[model samples]
Target: MKKYLLLMTVVLAALSFTSCMEELGSYEYMDANEIKIDSIKGQSITQYDTLRIVPTITQSRNTSEENLEYLWYWYKSGAGENAKIDTLGFDRNLNYYVAAVPGLYSARLKITDKETGLFARKEFDISVEAENSGLLILSDLNGNANLSLLNFANIFSQDIYYAANGEYAGTNPVGIADIDNAGTDLHMIAILCADGRGGVVTEPTSFVKISDYSDLFYVMPQPIAPEAYCAVAVLYNTGMGITYDFIINNGKLHYRDFQYAAYEPLFNPEVSGDYSLAPYAILNNNTLLFYDNKNYCFNILKCSYGQLKETKLDPVPLPEGTDTETLAFDPRNVGLEMVYAAKGWKKMDNDAGYAYGIFRKPGSTDLTNMYCLRFNIGYNMSMGRDYFTPYFKHSISGATDLDKATAFAMSRQDPYLYYAYKNKIYSYDLEFDKGKVIYDTDTVVGPGARVDYLYFRPDNESFNMWAATSVEGSTEKTGSIHVLGLGRNGDIVKVDTVYRNVCGKVVGMTYKNR
Candidate 1:
């Protein structure tokens, strides 16, 4: 029985093998001769950047041995959806310039077999960064304004509005106001001027949106009295699509277009004298902080975004005899909202330190819950005596007493505060409560140079400080703009005198992202 089963199994296997061979012989095949497009990948580009792409055509067994034709085009979405696709020359390699406004874009490449009727297509995407980013130097040319532009790509200055626009030509520019508008391209620049500042107009003009190399766009008007503005700042609330341009002129604070009238004279009208100090003020955390030099107090007003106008001037209560000119609001302090200011009438206060305080407003109440502290101690006992030592070889050497707060710049990225006194720069560490002289302008700008203004570059991680120093008794009012590079810990790393022989004293300086 076993032999008979084995015989039957062998016979069945033989019959199956023969059937499989017959099925394989009857199968049909075709040649692969079609043309295919090579996949193209997406790209990222900056505005005005050149993007080069090369595409290849894949040929199969049936494809003809003929030259291939190519075409490339790109288009952007949004309002430019109806715009024409920029066509490139008939070439396999595309060298395109990404000059369009920053946005997402789509591009296509087409290939055709010249000899055969076969064709193929490919598509890809691109992202471009926003343009018009640079630094604007408002050269107060002895009252006549000269707008000097310094793009990141270049170090030298270029007069962006000199002969380009007739309106800004030979105009006396008091200062320029800039606001960082989130989301939209509403970031605008307003050249503020008055008859006193050597400007053609007596009052400030509307904020002008810059286009195509400082060409003035439509102006966003702000109500202003025919008076010279001492300080100006633009507050933008992108979430609510509202903007307010604030200006301090003739000892009055004005905002919006007469939405509400100016703050009811925060200063004493009896003080009839020329206060040469430019009104010191800054916009911080949705609040406008200004110094009432006439009253010797700090004034705070909670700004309402997108409100057509303010109904009344509700100022946060502040102690009188506060030094507004020496006020420095530290943006780095998040938890404790502290503002540092040199206390005026030092004899009355008798405090060895500047009058700085932390304040908080609760709920809907206008009252400010506050705590004031005088940080007069310069040397930290915990770190020993030498730990607070500073390098003073070429710059102002020696220890700095924190009592004379004078003019200071607050670092946004670190706990260090840079203060200028006489011709020396001092670094004060808030965390350790220690202070030391970091840089001296005595050797760099000659003996009699007095450091007046200090500015911290907001866009730089290195915490680069720009200082303006004027010679004590120079007849020409000659000064120099020095750039000091600081280390991560906020110590002076290097120094460079970028501008020298400045004819006029620099009243104020701030970094503006173009």
Candidate 2:
């Protein structure tokens, strides 16, 4: 009886163990779909170049029974909140793509197990470089309205009157201003000082807008004046949705809009005398602030997009006994686009020329005292002096030695103010209040070359400074386009003479980024 009972107990125990093992196996079984993305790297290509995306995907569970769907999408990389993701295409295999523009792009690869409705996604970044990237040099054909175009990408190639109308007389460009409207870039070439032929002084002062490749858009008439062209500044009013072309003809400030057919003068003539020098103007707080050399004061003009108004801002005071004619203002400033006037005076009885800076705030309308630059001129500098000698520097030995600041071009994006001093280019750090020689024109081009004007590339990363160079004593009225790299310290990094022996002196040069 006892043996039979023990055998029964063992049988029961074995049956129970078998049931538990079967339940455990059922719970541990995994039927969920699994996928792994093998392509997680980035890519790089030039603008308009083709890109291929070959993705390797693997499914771990029931691979043979499952069908997968693939989707590809892309958008501008680092677009942040403004990113608008666009679908590239949908296919089982997305292997091709092309970016039509230059910028960083982000691409996504999505794969879904169609049967199980399970999906996985992977993303990558791509960089597209600009295709037509380099420089466009506007030069002259020696006193003729025949301007030459020298593309730095193909430095040796030359084209004359790149985009001129045969009906237009030969006009020397006094200044070139670029305005980027929406996505289209427009260049305003101020036609002035033309020898009696193509749109000369008698032909009615005017300017033409052209596309980046020198295609003509329209020719607009400027105020008829015998005054030599001083400067041309182009700016867009975001508020009123207007584009303004401000021109200084023989010291008078006049403006015209693309929407209008006529040019109009700004401010009343009773406020001051003829603006003697080119009006140095800049955009500040959506208003235009300019320096009036005749009055030796800074003035402000505002545009609401439809009409213009003057701020009635008081003029920055000039130094006592300093002739307003001897003072020149650099339109470029470190911050807020304020006006900085440089005045140098070497009295007939004195051997040294005293130079100093006068500053005004962007929106200030008070005529009270203007801020003065209390710093030294040369290597060694101390605080508190409102002026310094332009010619003599302690480190630059000799009498009547060292170049004085001649022409000025302030980096629109940096704190450094560039000036053509003594035939060389020097950069002055407004923050550090120190000056450094960036390029030696005597070495880059030749001695006796004068930089009539300087243009800094609006996009600062290129480290480029374009100068319109003219030789003082050259028999032929010729000029050259000098390109200098502003990246390195102490000396200029890259120097290229894009065009030489131009028929006429280069009065102005600017870059239009494509």
Candidate 3:
């Protein structure tokens, strides 16, 4: 009871503080000017808990509500693609009296109907990161359940548990544990920063429900690093964070003390010019690509001690002629698509500059002849004049200093990268040249600095991500920790979100080896 009260009080106080904060002067109440969005601006990650949800919500008329009906939606995933999978029709204001489950699920609601008997339905796919997935359910610490593992990857057999199988019942078993008891395994283990609390299914018939404990996984030392926050589930094997550990425990995963190895790059900037570095990383069979906007000519950087070395994949010129900003290696080689951004320019592309392009080049080893993204600042980050790159190449480019290419951990999913800019997250589909918004702060920016610190846990099948939003002096006191759900077909679901209103600063997030 005491723990519950403390948690509630902390969350409520934070919520109040956020609401009391003043709005920026740049954004004022404009009665005349209006920015209308045909759909919700960016309904990226939704949540079940209201009070715990950091950014306070009031009202907004900036969206198009013509077709949005006052209806409810619920789905196992965030994509509202298949209505059947995304079941609809439920309570209007109050869906689940309490936050439904701790796992990530897709759901949204529309106001009232005006045109027809039904109102317009604005179904924006949202990831709900239940904030309490790791908290032990005090009421049922003894009641546990066991799950029969379906060896799709290794343990293949006739027995399998599908969505049709009444959802996974049985509690208080042994061996198996829930990284975080989110009620439903809507999120696979390590799908997002490790929930820590999950059911454990052991060989000798043992299981432990995730709801049994709050300490599913914990960082080893005094203060935990921010980057050890949330990790995206891609290749469970590769564990890395900006400044923390992607540790594992008894099959569960979370942050812990680990080794730190920093080295410098071996190569130097010898390209078309001294272009900003934009190295790329891919995950899930090159289906996704992440980029950093360093705009340096080189990509791979081996940091040893305080020195950094650049390992060149291709031979090029100097930092004089080119005006590019990023580079990438589609880990799967797939050679080229092996891409980089912002090429063919003198400097920041003074004359409206160049439009960043995704290109391909040669590679080392068996990584060749694949789809490589190639272009000079003259033809950068763009397919053609008709379609533009998601982001531009100019400083005028919305890219922030923090906007640099993200070096994906050395894993099977090498290229599907994770990065943040202006404190927003975007996942790129190299195959489709498409960008998906993972989290957005147009709802609430400032008072905090948003940086991308993602980590992956091998055992728990989850990853953690953190956005440092609030600060004091030079200290970061609050952050919205988000869990990324890795599911079928590069599908993403937000498991949960939490704000740490404590004393800490997010050091460049990276995972440490134990």
**Candidate ordering by TM-score (highest first):** 2, 1, 3
Per-residue lDDT tens digits of candidate 1, residues 1-514? 9999999999999999999999999989865356676756987665687778866567776444456778888776433447568785577788877677655567788777776656778888876644534455555555555555434443534345553454452334455545443333344444555543323211111213233211221222222222323222222211222234454554455444212334321111112232211244433224344444433333444434323223333333323554433433322121232234332111112111223332232222122232233322111211121111111111111224434444677665565667777888888665455567787887786788777677765434345777877775554536577878888676888875457764344444544443
- Please give each candidate's TM-score: 0.51, 0.54, 0.25
Q: Model 1 RMSD to the real structure?
A: 13.6
| Candidates ranked by lDDT | 1, 2, 3
Off by over 4 Å in 1: 1-96, 102-132, 158-174, 179-188, 192-242, 257-310, 315-407, 442-448, 459-462, 470-479, 496-504, 510-512
- lDDT score at residue 206, model 2, on the 0-100 scale: 22
- Per-model C-alpha lDDT, please? 0.48, 0.47, 0.31
- lDDT digits (tens) for residues 1-514 of candidate 2: 9999999999999999999999887875667788778866886664555666677778887556338777888887555788798887777555454555555678888888888788899988865544432343344444444444443244433333333344332445444333333212332343444342213221101223232211111332233332232222322211122244454555565554444424332212222344443245433223344555544444444444334444233333224565534433322122222234332222112112233343444554332323334222221111111222222111211111113444676553354567674576777654444566666667756787777667665433356777767776554645666777665442467775545665355555444332
What TM-score does candidate 3 reach? 0.25
Question: Candidate 3 — what's its lDDT?
Answer: 0.31
Per-residue lDDT of model 3, residues 429-512, tens digit only: 433434455555444444344543444433333333333333323322243334455433333455444443321323222221
Q: Give me candidate 1's TM-score against the actual structure.
A: 0.51
Candidate 1 has an lDDT of 0.48
Instruction: Please list all clashing residue pairs in model 1, or write none if there are none.
Output: 33-62, 172-198, 296-322, 395-440, 396-440
